[model samples]
Target chain A: MIDAKHLTKTYGTKTAVDDLTFTVRPGQVTGFLGPNGAGKSTTMRMILGLDAPTSGTVTVAGQPYRDHPRPLQVVGALLEARAIHTSRTAYHHLLALATTHGIGAERVRQVLEQVGLTEVASKRAGGFSLGMGQRLGIATALLADPETLILDEPVNGLDPEGIRWIRDLLKGFAAEGRTVLVSSHLMSEMAVTAEHVLVLGRGRLLADLPMSELLAQAASDVVLVRTPGADELGKALAGIGATVSRTDVDALEVTGPSAGRIGDLARDLGISIHGLVPKQVSLEEAFMDMTRDDVEFHASAGSAA
Target chain B: MSALETQAGATVPAPRAAPAGPAGPARLAVRSHPVSTRRVLLSEWVKFRSLRSTAWTLLAAVVLMIGIGWLAGWGSNDSWAELSPQEQATFSPVDITLAGYYLAQLAVSVLGVLLVTGEYATGMVRATFAAVPRRLPVLWAKAALFAGVTFTLMLLAALLSFVGGQQLLGEHSATLGEAGSVRGIVGVACYLTVVGVLAVALGFLIRSTAGGVATMCGLLLVLPTLGLLLPSSWQEHVLPYLPSNAGAAFFSAAPSADSLSATAGAAVLGGWLLVTGVAAAVTLTRRDV
Candidate 1:
């Protein structure tokens, strides 16, 4: 389990992570969602003790990361940067890290094979393609067989097959009762893979909701109605606490009231209805709606096009 | 076995095998060892030897040590007949034997800087720190492994230079038994070891490659030359303490006027290194990676 309480990180006058308090429990994948520069990487760095938190404390299992006797064994983090030296072969790089914890060469070979990097183990990491490098990074993270895996944008440059491979790997890790935290700006991907999400916007927590809960709350399940006496029907629906959004001159999107109830009320009121359809809310719209107010950089070029 | 593919057989657990222990369920034991200084030292040795640059730099230092010393001895012997009476009377065979160290120290020390700074330049420090989050072991391991290798190898180069140089000197040659001869030879290797260690400390303090190399050059090379422009009275008090000038006293056949004795010079160089080391440790532990 990873726990961060009141964590804040600031660079000069700009705050990167502001007073974040959350717990990442084991047995599930927690998605860290944020736009670029929204503090996901900084928070991960703080947890790994790479960067000091400007204020507050973060711990893995219990104590800070530095206090762990076997840090690599406790947390395996694959940050955005490809941390391998470009000139060294993959075998040597893994061996160097393995030796630090008195880990044997056998474990190194196992991890290399585990990541499908055994074939290229002798090759210089500089020559590996983007997907290969990502695999190598994952191999290093698994070298110690860590209990908590924190991956930052693990699917950035992967093919569809590779993406599915990582998704299954993450699910497997979680099923093994390991804590898995995956960060990504890709909402569609996170919607499918993550069971719980911690969304950040402008360095502050915007939403800390379960995936199913968020999807259900964003679930449109709304009844749309068109009638000649729309004004009278709107007042009656409002009296029943159903939220009515005027979508057109004669149509309204009604929430809270079931289609059967709205139809019965309209018929009893003697108002003729032209259309009564329930609108389904897409997952993409739910994610966009949550972050719509949080996107710091407006896309001027895309808007222009 | 294919990567990530487990054998579903009865021979093995077919999944994560658990060690027999009470730490958790008789399942996934998560065998992991703690970081040890010895392991870090071994890891550093692996890093130090794997790079193409490490091989080339060590080779260059060895070649420079033997090549320049041999050339200096040969040149001195060839000019013996043309030397005036006073010049002949003042000639010292020991000086010619270790002359290559002046150039070789640059090569050895720059390699020291690269040993640590190269990781930073290539974004490998993150991987390094991620493995050992306490951070200082990485610095200490680099320094220990680097100093150990440099001292061992450079000492051999110095011995070779001395043997080859004395041969070139012919009748004018000095034996190791001669006054100040062994000191001149061994002192050059000792001085280079100190230089290499100081460069490693400077590398951790200044993470940038260009900056670390430039600072090393300024400390060992430029600052000493700049000392020449100092007023003569201040030069006697200040120049003798500069890293290069003090290191110069170590390999000299006799202590020059206005400079510290060889013992004092080594101590002064050691002092500079100690300060550099402490500063490096403090900065490394205090700063963010």
Candidate 2:
């Protein structure tokens, strides 16, 4: 289990992670979600004790990570940046880290096989593709079979099969009663893999809840209506206190009303609704809505749209 | 394309094998040992030996030490007849046979800097520190391992250079039993080993390959040359204390008039190592990786 209280990190007046307090329990995957520069990496570094917190404390398995007699057995982390020396072969890289904890070459070979890097194990990391590099990083994290596994952007450069493989791997770890905390900007991946999520924006906790609850919160009542008489329906819906916005020449997006209610009202008003579909907000959309105001780099207004 | 297929084929254990259940083969029952100085030293040894640069740089140091020593011996022998009585009187065969360390030290210094800076350049220090979180063990281990390796390899190089250079020197050769000859050969290795340790400390303190190399070279090579611009009185007080000059006094068979004694030179170089080592430890433990 990982517990952090009042964690904050600042660099010369620019705060990266601010006042974050949360507990990551075992037996489930906790997704750490944030946009770029939102301190997900910084918080992970602090948890690993690679970076000292400006204030507060973060501990893994009941004590600070550095205090663990065998830190690799307690927590294994794959940092966002590639941490393997490019000049060294994948096998040697894993061997060097494993040797620190007296982990044997057999365990190193096991992790290599687990990550599907057994074939390229003897090759220098500099020659590996992006997907291969991610696999090596995962292999390094899994070397000691720790109780808690922390991975930053684990699937950033993975292929579809690799992504699916990592998802299963994380789920398996969780199923085995190990704590898994993965950070990523990819909400779709998290939606499938994470049972719980801690969302961060501008270095503050925006939401710390179960994935089901978050998805439920993101579910909107807005319905999309298609009709030849969209203008008439929009006017009628607006008059009845529903938010109506024209999306196409013949369609209207109506909020604050159920699809069935919109259909019945359209029928009553002779609007001749041909299509009425309720919009379901995806985790991606929910995340965007939650962090829209907190995005650090805003592409000039309409450019992104 | 064929290689890609083989890679994909190997990875497809069961295309869509049910995610490894809690009791799957994915789990390995491996035992973990606590981090200790010995294990960290072993880890560092592996890291040191795994890199190609280590082998190449050490090879360069070895070859330069022996090869240049031979050349210096041959050159001095060829010029012996042209030497005046005063010049002949001042000539020390021990100094000529061990002179290759002048160039060999550069190779050793570069390797020392690369040992630490290479990790920073590749982001590997994060993994290293994460594995051994108390962190200082890693610095200490690298220094200890590097010093051991440098001393062993450079000592061998020094011995070969002395024997080979003496052979080339013919009648002018100095035997190991000659005064200061044994100290010259052993002291060259000791001096290079200390310089290597100092480079490792500088590597940690600077944490950049270029910056560490420049600073190390500047202290050893440039700083001494720059000192000549000082007044002659100031030069006597300061130049002998610079890292290279102080180190030279330890290994130089014919001690210069302005240089410190052998024991004092070792102390001064030891002082340099202590100061840089402490600063490196402070930065390493206190700063973020």
The candidate that wins on DockQ is 2
In candidate 1, what are the lDDT values of residues B1-289, reduced to their tens digit?
A: 2123212111211112222223345344445688877878888988887899899999999999999989888988888999998878878888777888888888987899999888888778988999899998888899888888888988899899989999999998889899988888778888899999999999999988789889988888898889889999888988899988798798888556777888899999999999999999999998888
Evaluated at residue A142, the lDDT of candidate 1 is 80
Give the DockQ of candidate 2.
0.57
lDDT of 2: 0.89
Best by TM-score: 2
lDDT tens digits, residue span B50-160, model 2: 999899999999999999999999998988999999889999999998888988999999999999999999999999999999989999999999999999999999999
The regions of model 1 sitting more than 4 angstroms off are A221-282, A301-305, B1-30, B84-86
Candidate 2 segments whose C-alpha is farther than 4 A from its true place? A301-305, B1-19, B23-26
Docking level of model 2: medium
10 residues in a row with least lDDT, candidate 2 chain B: B9-18
User: What is the overall TM-score of model 2 with all chains considered together?
Assistant: 0.96
TM-score of the second chain of model 1 compared to its true counterpart: 0.88
